[model samples]
Target: MNKELLEKGFIPDEICKVLPEGFQDIEEIASSLHKILANNQITNAVNEITQEKDLSKLTNSELERAMLLYSYVGHAYMWGKEEVEDTIPENIAVTWYEISEKLDRPPILSYASYALNNWALLDESKPLSLDNIRILQNFLSGVDEDWFIMIHVAIEYEAKNVLGSLKKYYLDEDFENKNLEDALTSIKKINEIMNRMPEKCDPYIYYNRVRPYIFGWKNNPATPKGVIYKGVEKYKDEPQLFRGETGAQSSIVPALDALLGITHSNDPLREYLDEMRIYMPSEHRGLLAGLDKFLEEGPKNKVVEHETFVNEIIGEVHKFRNKHLEYAKDYIFDQALKKQSNSNIVGTGGTPFMKYLDKHLKETVPKDD
Candidate 1:
């Protein structure tokens, strides 16, 4: 797809200039503002703005900065520190909520709003966080304008499509004996869609330009250490920042893994990848976990033919994941050339969980008694 194809309807003509050139000092300004919000000083500032009858009273620069503040502060409040409650505090939430609503819901503002409000609706006890799926509903409504957010919306679209196709088999009592070929076909279709995502959104540009501004935690080696928020003194010693890629990178991975019989192997790297699901909306996560259980006890356990078909599906899924890893590698190499940086890129391809599944599938050979 051409860049124009993605850019046409979503981005406004005025905001077209807002990204690369218009926001040169956004990082510095966003960092300073993040600290103030983190310190809970936002109540007064937010109250001041709430009193304004019209947002047009603010200058253009101020309006843009407010946009950045909504993005940064919202992320910091939700994911910055390891607070007991995952929900955003009321004072800060009201400020960003009102600001985002008044601005007609920009991509970042919508993203943060979904994170703050939508997640609380799901049951926390379930392993599969389906709340992530609820957030995708907003994306489907054409709220996301950024290329990065658009890519995620596309991913979730394809993922849900695959799941919807498989729902009938999941509900069927004779699902094991039902033609497994249909499920395989759906998996193949999803793989094709995923393969095109990087083409639609250039990973190189996304990593270098867009990724920096959206990052919450200081985990990315490419950027400086993340900013420290003021409140939650206990977290001062060891703060946790969230990178934008963490949630999007593997949103579909766990669900596919569960379908393909990829279990948690307890490897450190595998665990790290699994932990990223915490950032996902609980609803989608729960759906993945539920599908995993159904496969484990229903289809995979029942018949020899079903086992063979499942193994084939697992192989295809592994190939699909490896393709994504290749894309990551190519993006890193392309960026390295521009920066002339020699840093090694590790963990570029298959996760340990994927590898474990591949090995397990390979080792399971039919035996005659």
Candidate 2:
């Protein structure tokens, strides 16, 4: 163990204590963190630390707990959502963006993004949901790269179940009439999941530890101003800047758009969807491109059925979006009660994008239909 790193607070002490000796390497630390998470030792630690309201005043143990939660949640979201032969990818030691650029893949692509993006095109059954957005907005105290990563985890987890239900319904010819009902049922299940997420972390703590990493292009008084692509050298002088609803993490929205047959105008959202693919794994991005080609060149009758099914799915998606908007409002209001600014809540700005796509889908019908 690196005693200097632990003493300097570069690495959380709690994690250092739990880590196996000679795991002095940072990558080894990251790997061991996931092992503890997989075994469920970190669950209690996460719960205990999140209970603290003042992150600024957090003891060393509490800080360790938070770091472990952030690291493990991200690790699980990245590797654990699906059944992989190995929990950590062989390339786990590489810097995230470097792995993506060198391998031409999304650095942190998870099961949720993969499943939602490909489920419509691939004839595979997997379990998915969208309620994690609500939990993220309402429960999490801060937003950062790790926070963004976990949002995908939540999305993938919920989306897995939702996709599982949809796959089963579509595979069963007898359940033809119940398709819409099943989609609605999936949305309701997502709502139930959102209702059950434990509201732990103190917002103040989140602001102190996590918020600094999520700044927009506007300069701010923070150590890590916006996300820095460490291994990418082209931007050595200037790091990339991202605000709400931008970046690879937001891929779920466009994936859903593709699945639901919602086309976007040449607007910012459209540009965002196009640009965000750079952040996806190469194979995942290829699958998305394949889905587009499939939609364009597939058989007419099959396309019609897909469009009809997607229209129904979009209707449910609209309802889900509205539900999230409602939650955002309530969550922001709750923050107001604590005298905390509501500006930091996640998913607050998603309503406009959702509304735009929903309207677009409602106005357009399959020409074959």
Candidate 3:
């Protein structure tokens, strides 16, 4: 693929210049492409393994291993296609089915299900539907479902990376809050999946996948308009106004107004906007921009501000403790016939996996963009 991409002159010099610090060599890109191809080949090998209508040709153990291998291959191929913004050929799905037939296990069949159902939406260019969400929900509820994580990653990457322009397009057209909420929910589920992954996994892949969803979540109108700048001198041109009904000063309101202006494409040439509002010197713009920027950079710059870090940690801790207490008082004891310990829990209801999130908050301050 690298050779093809290089030959076709698709590798822009500027894009190559910013080739993500670790991916310095062209050969590494080639190797990654080969890995994707090799995975596809393994999926094809299932036909040979199952030939002559002979279930006796392969032992149960061999069939199980082959199915497991196919699952891994499908995941790798899916990730590769996403990274390059390319599509897998339709022939790949045939191979997926072939491999799935030989396998005795449910996991391989699950992958085959993903390949079939997902390809219809992804490769066949069908719109995302409530049915697709139901399928995803069921898959997540299934056992040994690594493909759920991969599928979650793919959806998130598409929503966050490519959907930003689409989101702005929707914003420009003034879509209703329900449409925006549905979009945000998709990304939110992606975040939940990413957060639930085991710590040993490479977080960069998860981060890259979920990064775009952040912007999608924020741009939605259903989000709360939190307090940003407080008691700071207001912009002379944008003075605080008193509401007729409440009689409270509209400091935060103005900040939100500015944000809507900046994000919703309300007169970009007016010089009042550049991604975020700035007249309010308080940490609102800084805080919001900080989170967005960090995620946008993926894992290249992992550090975060001290106050933000602390706040995030505190928030997660409170969330976990509350959920744990709720589950303990209401459900876990009945389901398992035993009390649960903190160590046995995971995610928002479990002990901290990323303690650095809170620690970084206390130790560092955010530098300006």
Candidate 4:
């Protein structure tokens, strides 16, 4: 529960692309994933990887790469083609599930894989920004897909600007008002970064190409009963439901919500946000837990600046949520429906996000009760 994020926010300090010789085959598949998908060679290519590779003696870093590679390949196998596949092959399923169990998250693509651990700096000496950063993986490569992930990376970079202050705010017994104020400023800046999404990634392209590969089995018509993992004993070959990679799984907003005492209305969306906590890295989830306890008697005083700080924080939250709602409408809700896979009604996270996001936006008032 200690403040582990000093500079990187939720992003790992490095992507650690270098793996042991055992993982070389998996790494090879990940390198040309788009080509494999284009030629419909995913099934055999991925299964062959687990055959020789003994996952028993790998490092945590190696497992992370396993998650990343398997997730990209799994999504591509399911959604890369015209029709969705219902069953995950045995080797792919077992390898993905084993690594997922080691990581304590579901066996599907989440935000951590999509953006948090998916980027690398072009110039190591330079700061982490869109200009210096590039993604390590892709679904079906395109500007729309690359831009979509990098934009999230940019926002994550900006969010870290507040982490030092937030860490101080969390650890200090006094709940320093200065720390809170500094974080409010960075939160406002994070919203500005989010505004740049449409500058390159066209909403049309994002809704179609970029989003399809990220959708999970839950609440999805393509795999209506969820997905079956062929050889994973934990599932007994039953279909398992897991939400897809979504911003809801990101820790930035949730940490702010816990800190600033912002509360969403009691609804399914609230439940969904709570459910997303499990998808996040364990440390982030612990940070939120610490903040909730830290605030019990903390933020302890109500000085003149306290009201102003709280109001400004609330204002930024409003702006962030409203802007997200606007983007949701443009990027997903209002876009023309082309395929059953990319439904305008349901989000990639496998929820009726259009309805819930609008409600969640309206419910974000200047003050919480």
**Clashes per candidate, residues 3 or more apart or on different chains:** 16, 14, 2, 0
RMSD of each: 13.1, 14.8, 23.3, 2.6
Compose the digit string of candidate 1's lDDT tens values, residues 17-135.
12233333433334355454445543333333322223445553344445545455455444334342234444344444444445544213333232222222134464222223232
Candidate 3 local accuracy as lDDT? 0.28
Candidate 1 stretches greater than 4 Å from native: 1-69, 72-148, 165-172, 176-179, 218-226, 231-240, 247-251, 288-299, 344-369
Judged by TM-score, which candidate is best? 4
Ranking under lDDT, best-scoring first?
A: 4, 1, 2, 3
Which tens-of-lDDT digit does each residue in 290-348 have in candidate 3? 43443344422222323343233233323433433433333322322233343432221
* Each prediction's whole-model lDDT (CA): 0.43, 0.38, 0.28, 0.78
**95-120 per-residue lDDT for model 2 (tens digits):** 33432344443333322122222212
- Which pairs of residues collide in model 4? none
- Pairwise lDDT winner, candidates 1 and 2: 1
Q: Weakest 10 consecutive residues, lDDT, candidate 4? A: 296-305
Candidate 3 residue 236 C-alpha distance from true site, Å:
74
- Total backbone clashes of model 4? 0
**Model 2 weakest 10-residue run by lDDT:** 3-12
TM-score of each: 0.52, 0.47, 0.22, 0.91
Prediction 2 global C-alpha lDDT: 0.38
Which stretches of model 4 miss by more than 4 angstroms?
A: 4-8, 174-177, 294-299, 302-305, 337-344
